[model samples]
Target: MALNPNVPANQEQRTDEIDLFELFSGLWAQKWLIVGCSALALLVATAYAFLATPYYEVHSILRTTQLKELDELNGTGVYKIDPEEALRRVGASLDSYETRVSFFNANRELFEPLKKGSGSLENAFAAFNEEQFTLLQPDPRKTSLVPFVGLKLEYPADVDGVAILNGMVRQAISDEKVRIAQDLEGVIKSRLNVINRQLTAARAKYEASKENKIAGLKEGDEIKRAQLQDELKALRGELRLRRQSRITQLDEAIAIARSLGIVKPTTPTSMGQDAGAAQGNIIRTEVFNQQFPLYFMGSEALEAERNGLLKRRSDDHTEPRIAKIQHELQLLENNRQIQFMQSREDEDLFLAALADLREESSRLENIKLDLSQLQLARVDRPAIEPIKPIKPIKMTIMALGVVLGGMLGVFAALLRVILRRKANALA
Candidate 1:
């Protein structure tokens, strides 16, 4: 009992060191017990792995081909629905509970096999929500200009998950097509309405101008008469210029035709003195007939004449025929001027407005064609049967079990050693 303070402190330090070493040695002595506990945990893990049902996943790819860029109609740009955005909304809609419920309801038989343990359709739907569904675009983080998306479905290994996914994809595509058509139709109809209104306004303006009668000379309005005279003079000048241009075009066209051996004179040898005169007359007639066939005859008659003319051959009499053709062309120009002079300013406006309305009508027809032909989205790749189950990775589960079981066993052994030490101390 007469121990020094330094000796007691040293003894306590030594005891602490021994206790630390004894902990490891104690665990070593009960290594077999630890191994047995680990073996039991491994067996439990194995049983759970075998008992759990495996699930397989199948996926399909979709492509959005809707008109994303602004569409050009009648030289004006119009907005169109973005295909990528529409596809994104469709994907989001698929993820919604309501859409999923609808899908389940529509194809209850497909989901029925998934309801092995479920009590009713609702419970089956609940089970599906818990374990079977995922709809998403692939690689959303990556910036891609292409509108590619993916839909995935998981089910029990025995179920036809691929068929279910395919059905869903088909339904989605049908719905999107209908939506795109309706939207495009609405846009086209709205634009048509606007164009019609504009046309109406233009017609009204033209009618009002006619009622004002400012385009023509009135009986007592001297200033208006002078203005009409000036307009008439300008019209005459333009008509004369157009006539001259037409004459030139006709001359060149006749020369080209003569060069091509399409125009000819029928010379008769029986009438020796009249032969040259007959040839000249025939050439003039042929030139006039070819250039202004529709002027004298109906379109059908003109076509018939053209067919007959095509059968005839001609010799090159370019130098002598030019003067005669020029004379005939002058007569045609004189007739065109008479018709042009008869047209009033109001009549010209009306004709211009009519042309515009016809153009608009043609544009509307094209829009209708586009609506009918448009395809918004399509199934790029269909889902197929999965070769392997995605779930219940046995190796991973076994490895996890081994590591966790070993740690728990070690903790149990340490606890046993500590309890024995306490019992011994109490004794």
Candidate 2:
């Protein structure tokens, strides 16, 4: 041990080389075992590649609907659905578990493979949905890309994947159409109900106003008639009093004319009644004036007026206001405005905007939307039958098997060599 301090560096290098050579010799001795393991692994990989069930992948691309395809829906103005929204709805349906289950149930013949397992049909479908179905969409951050949504499905080669994917897309479009149509119908019905209620209210209001107007007319007519009757009665009473008074004045004038022995209208001078001048009485009083009393108009004229007044049967024609009152009362017998309102047959005419509303409703009712050919989303690429299986890549599996066999062979060889040396040293 003390003499090892003087050993050259070259000697240590030779010792390391010998140890590496021994390691190579030990691996060469178990070459047959390593070959056997590699061959066995390669056999298993080849068998699996040929016997395993091959899976096929099918994909479809969906784009937003075009504006021209949605003309009928957008033209209505009352209800509208956008292209982006329609595409989004289809994508959502594709991602829905319920939608997938419904499709599965409706077309059970297509999903027969999922029923082969020991688990229930629902569990199989859940597994299939989780593993086999994929939803693809453009990344929001990728601005240069045209936005699109797609469905990817990987299924056993025996299944008709193309039919399944295309059918599902068609079903989603049909369902969206139905939903839009129902929404439109519901809105129209609600609007129609509101319009009908408004019409009823308008009719009721018109009837109330008509009744109020009729009542007011009747009241006014009664008041005017009563006032006219009162005025007529007052005029008649005044006429009667004037006639009686004239008769009394005529009687007095007659008495005075008879007592003076006057028979006709005459001046006092003409009758020589100026006694102050006839008796030569210069200082005697003399009355000089033109107008005289009603009696002075002469007893013959007064008696004639008194007899005419007494003979009068009515004084209605004497007052001009009485004739006017009677005419107004006749006019009030029936109000023309109220009559016009009551005699009308159509209550709808009372509502100002009723005609316009009816026209709008009729237009909406007549609206013809042909959704049989409505396109909710555009199919950029339809699913096609795949020619090759995407799983169990044969060349890659075989290569991995060779590498794994080599590793396992080397580990066994090293362990055997170490164990054999220890046993030899013990002996």
Best by TM-score: 2
As for candidate 1, its clashing pairs are none
* TM-score, structure 2 vs. true: 0.83
Compared with the true structure, what per-residue lDDT tens digits does model 1 show for residues 1-427?
3445655667645543438678899999999888887888888788777778888888887777646322332223343456676577567655666656766778888776766553876887787776767766767678877677777888887677887788777666555556666765677678778878877888788667655554342323445445555655555566556555654555555555455343432212322445365545343322232343222323333344445445434312323443454454444333443344456555535545678776776766575434333454556788987787887877777777877888899999999988887666445
Q: Which ten residues in a row have the lowest lDDT in candidate 2?
A: 277-286
lDDT per residue (tens digit) for residues 9-38 in model 2: 676455434366676788899998888888
Ten-residue region with minimum lDDT total, candidate 1: 285-294
Off by over 4 Å in 2: 1-21, 219-223, 226-292, 297-304, 307-313
What would you estimate as the lDDT of candidate 1? 0.63
Q: Return the clash pairs for model 2, or none.
A: none
User: Against the correct fold, how does model 1 do in TM-score?
Assistant: 0.54
**Residue 143 accuracy (lDDT) in model 2:** 75
